[model samples]
Target: MSIEEDRAVQAAQDTVVRETDNGYRVLGSPEESVTHQHDIDRIPQFDVTQEMVSGSGENQEAWLTYGGNYEMHRYTTADVIGPDNVNDLEVEYDISVGSGSSMEGSPVIVPGDPTVMYQSNGPNHIKAIDARNGDVLWSYTYAVPSDVVLCCDDNNRGPAVWQDKVYMTTLDSGVVALNRYTGEEEWYTSTADHERGYSATWAPIVHDGTIYTGSAGGEYGVRGFHTAIDAETGEQKWFTRTCPEEEFVGDSINQAAGTNWMTATYDEERDVLYMPVGNPGPDFDGSVRPGPNRNTCGTLCIDAETGERLWFHQESPHDVWDYDSASPRMLIRDLEFDHRDEVRDTVVNAGKTGWAYSMDAETGQLITRSDPGVQQLNMFSMIPHIDDGRRGTFMPGGMGGCDWHPATYNHETGLVYYKMHNNAQEAWWRFEEFEEGRKYWGGILEDETEAMPDEYNGHISSISAFDPTTGKLVWRDWIDSDTYLWGGTMSTTTGLMFAGTQNGQFIAYDAETGERLWEFDTGDAPLSSSPISWYDPDEGKQYIAIQVGGSGWLRRGKRDDRVVVFSLAE
Candidate 1:
């Protein structure tokens, strides 16, 4: 079939597949054929070496790592568009990449070629686009598995590029490497069995010659682990289970689940990888799973080369609140701690428990924890009347203190900016028989007879800037919306902070004062992915790009997927 004809057929097939209940299925096998429409040899080739990614933010060229750099700072040094003229920023171009349930993946631009970029959609659909004008260069659709069970929506974070290949993890528990130039598959490796509830949704981080990733099935009673695979050959180097054998509460290690569902940060100088591990299985009731749950709900510092654990610090021990330390742990250097009266190197993490923790990079020691970033009522309150069906309300519910959204840090001001939702969620418990390969939440948060509780009303969402070293709030601005602030924040050398709201607006704030500076409506399509910035080498212009469409809470808004790029008006 012709290229256009194939796309038409694929679109029809996608429509039918999306309408199915749950909208995701397991593929027969990894050897299944995928429809391709572009010539592999004819595509342009470019080098995305480790050196390029290491020093990516130093230049005005690319946004390499998922967090813009190995430090996971999410701060870009591009200064072409400053606060003085940011109001002049206007939409440059917008292109839709078909509709999906959610658009959480951030796009990565090729180094020195601002016009070419790559991104993934909700269903693990990968696309290579011309960043100059949002034109599709090539596309690859991953085969969905028919039997996979996903607690959340079908979401793929993004991809990592190294040398000549781009790597992405699929929802079907596999990782596939594609040629950087073309969208053709170079190699596909199964990371876990989807039938056992092991899946991957975060972007893989590549360093040296290895690609590092973690699995996501903390709610399905599957044992979680972090793996390092040979980037070029797709061979397993080493695997470290997030749950240590000694800490297993049950007879089998499978009862412990400490999934690493977020992208990790690397300290190249120290050769340490800081990965945030998710919550344990049987999410609500922890009775079945005993022990301290050592490695789960914590940050694990591993030797990147050997995948050996260097140190770990649990954020929530024996957690019954479902708090997962799954947000990006940002590495900050040479910060003066006013409380300690010394300068120190630290890794900071904003956790779902509503506190920001700063720890020593050399040894996993808690330096300080900031005040609660959100409302914190009924925290750690055990569920009462498991069989009586009595309802309980808790603040900073399962959604987050700061779930999955990447926070931004500013070196000049020594402040980290992150968003928080202050909605009180209803919690209740019931005795449900344990079933393998399925969601094992022992209780339900939202029971029948109430679409949503009246107590959930008047929800407040705010973004706060806090000093990680001293654990003090610098400034904060409350967003006038009831929904969660799902998009990640980005800081610029221009002294501005950018974040998107579920209410279809991209808003900017003054980095120092938290003053609202600018706002642009995104045509009612909620911006769920983090915003990134880059300079167009050909045009000598700087632009901020973000994926818009689909809401954060289970893709509640419009599903029109589009990458919207903005720049100063010419």
Candidate 2:
């Protein structure tokens, strides 16, 4: 069969077997991915070198890492699939991610003799499949202990590849490495004890033979940390506590619960890492955790190799609203602002506070803060106790004006594309003493989705663009839906942005104007994961893929954990 024809043909879903009951409960054997007529050697072997990862922008054939490139720009340069022919894109194949998984991540594509991609499901389950025809190659899993304590819902945000191994962080706090081609376990390193409510939900980024990862469980009042592990030996190279006493504003102990819970952005040129830490413990009852909570609800810039602190900026000082700052920022060089006359290197933070912050990358100083991306209300007022019966209803109820969803940046246009949330919640708090594995939340929230006022009622989210330099809103595409948009946007050089909706719509929008171009309904499941585009040189075809994982809070359709791929119809 012609390479193009083979790629356009939908791969059989049964090409790989999956358990329909519990996600990753029953593991596939080491050689389960090799089909009856499949030859494992058909796929080429190529090293995902450090240089390729750093220069991922130049290599559009694959998505090297989580942020696409170290700069954290999710944009691609693929030109084959674009605005004009996007309408012709059709389903190539759809496969199951097993029964009990919630895929909240994006796939890492590796183009080769037979291009293949690696995907991660909830609680640390991974699978490798042929990118061309969606033939399953291998599967691996690390079942999290039942006694493991969890702060957030169980969700794995995909995996990272370096040299010949694939890396995944587990809900049980294990960072396991697998053979990139064979899916066999090479080594396993536990980052934290799961018995103490510590877990690893964030996908780690591997750089220069070192894998960088951080812990979860800020809600459990655990002291947070980020560690660097040797990719080959699984030895911890460096360890840095996120909230040190000296970094705290008043040397208060309340600053102890900050965790670097999201994937970090790296500046390879300077050998520095930019990471966002989560909110402090007893989230709503801030009276106990006094003084700005220094490193919590903020972004930190540190040395990549040694894990030394460079500079830090606290976004929500004394944050009492559960405003855990987990949004990742882009490290843009030569950024311009309307108020400033000269251009400077800057990091544009799309924070949970619903505002975009442009900061000086060199010093971590605020350059400018743009208008609220969503409705930012009740600015950090003291939370009333639940007994008060005077619950405060506010916009961005813990879910954020921006959540963990990623925003893509277009350096050429200087406009960042983001999926903004317009959510509200009724909240109140109460204090609780620390206990080893128990939650430390000093408050609780009630969803007011039905009582939302007239103005913010129509849509749960909006796809918008902002000029990071001047803190301006260029355009916004409102998505009218009862459910929120869990998916993020990915753009290409062809002047188009692709995004998935919780309602199962895979849409194409004009990058310049936020105009809806084309859309496809991928069954009933929510497309909770982000979409990525890649061009395979041999087949000379560009394709798009996303995971319909549904939300942990609510799901729209029946096909919950499915991988759907699309390409131009033959």
Candidate 3:
């Protein structure tokens, strides 16, 4: 829609700018869109310590950190709203964020008697909601530049709450800190030059006093790097360049556009950071850069204190297919090995290469590569070495496999649950020079939905249960063969897995078995974001919340920002 059209729509008094389940619609004003809690003081003090954030998802009372508890587990100990009662789940309250974009980030529940929820929208809008009721506590929206270039949508995975402030990365390459007590801007630190195509769409992973975040825009030829900033003062502690010495493809790959866009899980035990780095510049056409790109498509183990490179693992060498290890890496604490008798801890990561790779936590070693999680056709074939420029189609395309959506590990089942895109893309290579702040891909690729291989199902996406210990796929559930499962998954101790679908159904499946136990239609919005569960002891009820509203969760759908939450039907 054009700006004039948007203004004309906004000018309409009857236009529903925001709508909640209780029929709270901002028919007149956009400022009233952010409903603040009247009894804000009754909530609690803005005091979330490092200890509380570290012990997140364990207490079953609050969800303090992303990845649940730094392991990126996305698992909750809360089992109140599980299997049997899951079918009786109904909407608790629904709050609309705005009409800008959908919700891609998880909601963080601050630890308190009556917890408050923090959510991030695609366009850098952060909101605080009263968990007890659906009252909007407060909201802080960062002013993103209209001209700034973003690799994907204007989405932030979520925010990191520590001390007295809430931290979030911006689409305009910014790290903004806001006062947790009242939605006020505390500080804004620039991570990279946004005009040069540098952005930070991932959530800032917060540690003791430092917050670690990465840069986006690998497609724009900007050199990839992650920074450590002081959580309180917004001071950059250290920055690590991906390929400072041209380590991977030697001199052939001069442009170091290996962006570390996702949030890296921290092994607080070893004081090491395991981050997944993305694809290098010019995604296709690896001829310009000869040798296999080393650190680009793999996991990088770094010293948490000093930002020093400890070890690295490259999944797809010379990743011409854009098979980036872009999915967030997780630290599996007690992973029992299938071949080796020893019970060694490993860092598990889902890849776009349609496989799950787990490496030794202390020493980065290929522990196991899970069986194919998605369809793989013409896997790793060279782009027809002909002078004539013609596009070649390939399965497990750029958007194939587990692209970006985080996987949850079930301790009971001992399997990883993640989404898979069985897609085909028509990719062609060309020689294009790196132009600053521009699309520098020496090639181009597009989704080829009309024509796919015979083995390809009619489904656009599916979810898989991968056995990380043995490198095998236990089950692949194509819940809806028609729509995509854009939203990610999260698990509970009750052996129940929670996820949302592109068809607007918030679903629950048996983690051990691929059985669809329950589902709820969340209207026209696509539930592209993952569902998070936290037990509220005050209400004596468990709540499951998800932000549903995004067009390009892979396919364009109705765009509405609604934070729909659920609990057992009273």
Candidate 4:
């Protein structure tokens, strides 16, 4: 179907469903009208080059990389608004970006031009807005298949900008580039076929002249891969499969699922790109897929120029649990550890197994593994007996120890901050044959009530700070929610930690002491994405921004889809 026809169908479907006060509503169509464009002369356009993005760690004007920098630290040096005056922070501007199923994208401000920011919503809708005021400049929508099978919600992480163009992946497994000034499409290319259960949900990263991205369909038994494309022409430069072909285990190519569903980090000096691979196919039942899955459930480092696999360190080998190492890998350089004599460069990642791992970036060797961040009862236990209708309880259920939320690293204190939840689930299985384009899992995960009492129903969620060098916990604070804390965390140079909760509170904590500093209620909606901060030169103020909307686990009532920016009240 053409793009226009698909949009018309979506609009027609939206008319039949209405949002109620209690939160239940069908998916709505994209906004037809665009926000009136502001005077272009007032906004300055800055050249966003590869060098600028590489050195984005010190960036105070704009957030270029997905994790706020190339190292994926999610830390900012801007300290104009610190803990001293954070209580005075108030909403500066809040603009609705249309009502959608989910809003997971992180807003990226134009380089040197903090007045302009770019964002994307669920269903692949892109928009450019005046950062100072909440006025949309231009918007673009991509056609989506009506019957796409997604294990999660229809979501897009965000976009990558280089030079004068913005690049993003479509819900139907296609990549497109757009003019940053005007939302006109420059080029588009199909990354994979949607019918085969291949999709792209995470943000793509652009370095030099190449754009890098990965596929997302491990739940559908899709053979995952990483692709590099020419940023200028949208031409395929190289493609490397996450699952190695030499190791023929379990249904071979068809059942080997090592999808990359999270944003990757790039090492400019080493010319290596680190990609996080998801779980193998048939998450609960891995009997058919035998042998230690080669590259799945691990971090794969590859040569950026040639797409060659440099090395891989598997976090979970021959896994029975759905412990995907899909979190963003934070690269820390010149790390001195108490255990080791030599200073080594390390990459740290949090896995669903409720453990944090730090590995040598160059050789993929295990540097250290921290104590369990969450409950680990029945962890690594054998798959439950499925001959009868009995169910078994498993800790750190499919939702994850640390899902796709990007963890943050604070350079000032040499500490890593991440959110984790302890939600044990009951599982039982029924063998089934694999079918094309269908959920190919060999069994089902059923709830086991007899295993635990009703009072123990709610999950425990907490935010933890740890030292990766010694695998020691620095501080831990439990949240007041039974639901998982799915949002990302951000640390600032002024010793402040920020994170949004599933219950709609955007919170700030004292980084050193884990004390609650300040919080703002975001309409009681889930802030599933990360929080970002940038300094606005024109106003001499530092603004913190985050996307607030409904997410997969917390979507029940009327939802609000908008980006909220906060700054100290004048």
Candidate 5:
């Protein structure tokens, strides 16, 4: 069939799938997904690489199977913990691993087993924990030469477990697959050259038989990209560079080059993998890489098997405020859009602009836009959000429209949740200055002094929910804070939304009403890691997990590092 014909057909199928009880609806019917009979017989197929269940069959839980749905995004679909009973939540386990940078990780539960694997920052390492009691079953640390130059926080976002093997990326640029039962290394491969300021902190996404991962090195002058590695053999399947060769080079020379520093999601029905890339190098300077930087600072969907680019959408072009496109993209269907008939398969991406852009997953067309309740647009404009907000905008001050942290999708209500801030900072141009051996430039390059806008106002940061189809605000819960907001979001099938903050609090809210359900003081800042949900087969109780660590970018200082888990009192 022609491409247009295929899109039209897919659009129709999407309407049927979404309107009826389809797979992976955040708050939709799980029983319907299991009952519907479809043409594809491979419905039970597991996305071992991305953790998404692909294949045609009535039984595959593609929507709720893995991370984003249950697979790569690591957000949960089980809603055992909700507003009515969230106050019953108590700290079940707290693991203190000395101290680290950003302990950004989500709990990956091995279906039908009590095993859940997670990771930690600072010297990238992986830990297998017993879900019932939080016992460390196995721990593997990949050694980086301690001196590698990394651009952002030194953290391992988490690991993916497939076919009894736990897969994770290291800060030193190595991808390792370990035995789930035993921490023995199964296979390993290097993702990038550490000497050139390239490293891997993203969690490995496994779908089918491939492991998909990206790099982290926009600040120190490194071009970024994403790759698919053979899950069983740890061999390279294919690689897609985020920053395609510049169409033309300019005199200023500072270019946006980094891409694929964050985790990605997969749409099994279409055999497509969606990846979000990061910012360009000299992050604040746009003179080097001009124009809407294609492939970089945008979302790229590829044919999962062939690694061929099907569609690319740029979220930020010439990103002058360090707004990297490396955030999570949630896949959903039956989303209603303005001027469009029926619901369409959609991808919801959270941006550092404090806006959530909804687009047709099959066509890359804009569906809707949303603001995260943050209070800054002038700063975004000053950083050159000038190109009609097409190519990246520095507005809202890129500290986060939503950073690399993950968001949650409730299939029940078709709402995706995330945390955002109202931050504005003025950065003056800094000539290439050698800090020890690392490159040091102002946040965004400007010759003269730029007056940083006052971020001090009514609490401007919030946790928001979006209607992916119409791009309408479902609900948003705000918090009073002096500093810009950080951390991430998660949702459950049972109707709860979880999040953390730089202000030292982990919050639980009503997924439908945005009401504060429960709150806990972690006594430390949680700047990066968002909360994750898992089911305890043994205790039959649902649990929430998060890593509490401080980010220099958020607090302008240091804080403690630890992982905390909560569950209903036994």
Candidate 6:
């Protein structure tokens, strides 16, 4: 079917039956009740309309929007989970789903409500939970076939909640929006040719009324691009191609390169979206993809409304190693630079090579770069490359100086905290089948070890704290593990940074001092599940909730599939 027809079908099917005041009932969705959302069309469109971007600045309805703040700090303002009462925590509920590859989805708490949403790896199922008692409210499983090319592991990064709708991307190359309250499908659309290497694993970002998401076409014969859809109706507004649209045209061979598998940030005031693209296709070799490979392996700032590429800065141009610059583009204000003159509104991007670059959010200008203080092999080629415009010998081989897990930006102390798994990743060229929906190539190993560690064995499993205002390394705490996988950093108004580690431990660090203040072992290894904090109205206290589940990437000495909550004793 044509894309327009597909949209129309979705629009027609977006109906709901609601209970009325008297007897019969209302045969319409919430949009019929809320006049503003009524004209948004039955089908959802991705472009950020003026309506989506414009809202009452006075509507301080908790963290009701994604990115937490317009900045995407992933931090909370609740003081519920602090050092004083952390010892009085207990498990509210424990439900286990038969496991799969890497569990990388970060669970999100719906504001002013006792609910959280997360997705499971392997199967790519979106699950929502009643945070208060750990009851499954609804589970939406994207019908994923048995055989499909999934890059890392069939993992999901979680979903974006906006205006009573849950926006999610599937591993099967689909961007779908569901009714937030009923879990009914509202609108769904394909991002790329899933039959090839394109998949959607990263969470979707909703800003200024437009839903921003990209595709994971790496290793597949596909090109990368970011698309904007209308949030109310899942309609495609515009798509910005990541790679060169031209190839050997009139010839026998043709190709479209580049894929953005991670989520980007939207600067509403400037009407721009900052995105990071993954490595070039044929993962380990860049010889096939000659030239600087324009937008791959870098951060790009584009006009969110028009999908126009404004400016791009490649971190690993001609990136042969799979050092995808695809981590979250953290937004901050009043950031400091190590050897600079002034503080400014900055966006910090951490990469696989273990360096964090602070850039001017408005102009995409380079501000300063920081090394989180780790050791690794350098990728500098002693022999200069034939002037193809590719620079070699960048520090920290791909496995990452820091990876995809979301970092925390603390407003209280102006610090950004992230987890850095320190290990040497080895890279070499290899031959492989280049099918999209199937495994293409293996990623560079952090070490020569063929198997993940049997114990928590990362060189430095601690959280690295930085002065985002200045891009200076403030402190690094080592957790002593082989690798720290799928976890996120959560900063609270109470001045605490909470993190879940591979060592079956959920730890709390002083936001300013980076001191390990408290910990509780969940009795299992975990990847990508972070601690979420909120205030409980019933008990009139603050609490930290974490999903304790084991992931294949971690040192799986134990298994824990539970939602553990901690609170302070009054």
Reference-based TM-score, model 6: 0.79
- Score every model by TM-score: 0.93, 0.90, 0.91, 0.91, 0.80, 0.79
Give the TM-score (vs. native) of candidate 2. 0.90
What lDDT is obtained when candidate 2 is compared to the true structure? 0.75
Q: On residues 287-324, what C-alpha lDDT tens digit does candidate 3 reach at each position?
A: 76777667788999888888888889998887888887
Clashing residue pairs in candidate 4, if any? Answer: 23-557, 23-558
Q: Could you tell me which 10 consecutive residues in candidate 5 have the lowest summed lDDT?
A: 17-26
For residues 248-358, write the lDDT of model 5, one tens digit per residue.
365222334556777778776887888887766666655545576667667888788877878877776666676666667887766666567767878888877677888
Compared with the true structure, all predictions reach lDDT values of 0.77, 0.75, 0.76, 0.77, 0.61, 0.61
Instruction: Please estimate how well model 4 matches the true structure, expressed as its whole-model Cα lDDT.
Output: 0.77
Highest lDDT against the true fold, candidate: 1
lDDT of 1: 0.77
lDDT (Cα) of model 6? 0.61
Q: Sort all candidates by TM-score, best to worst.
A: 1, 4, 3, 2, 5, 6
Q: Write the per-residue lDDT of candidate 6 for residues 499-530, one digit (tens) a residue.
A: 88877777778888878888777774664565
TM-score of 3: 0.91
Model 6 RMSD in angstroms: 10.5
Q: Which ten residues in a row have the lowest lDDT in candidate 1?
A: 15-24
Residue range with the least summed lDDT across 10 consecutive positions in model 4: 16-25
On the 0 to 100 scale, the lDDT of residue 102 in model 6 is: 42
Mark the regions of model 4 whose C-alpha exceeds 4 Å error after superposition.
1-43, 446-459, 553-558
lDDT of 3 at 41: 66
Please provide, for model 2 over 163-279, each residue's C-alpha lDDT reduced to its tens digit, 9 standing for 90 to 100: 899999977777988888777778889988877778887779998899999978877777788899999999999899887776554533642678888899888778888888888
Residue-level lDDT of model 1, residues 1-570, one tens digit each, is 233444522542363223323224433323343535553443457677778999986756788889989998888887887778888888989877764546888878785444668788766677777777666767777766667767676777788888888888988778899887767788888888888777888889999889999888777778888888999899999988877887875553675778889998989999989999988777777777677778888899999888888899898898767788888999988878876787888999988888999999999899999988877877777765466656666667777788888999976667899887666666666556666776667676642223333444355677899989878888877666545677689989878999988788898888998888899998776778888888876777788999987643332466657889998633
Ranking by lDDT: 1, 4, 3, 2, 5, 6
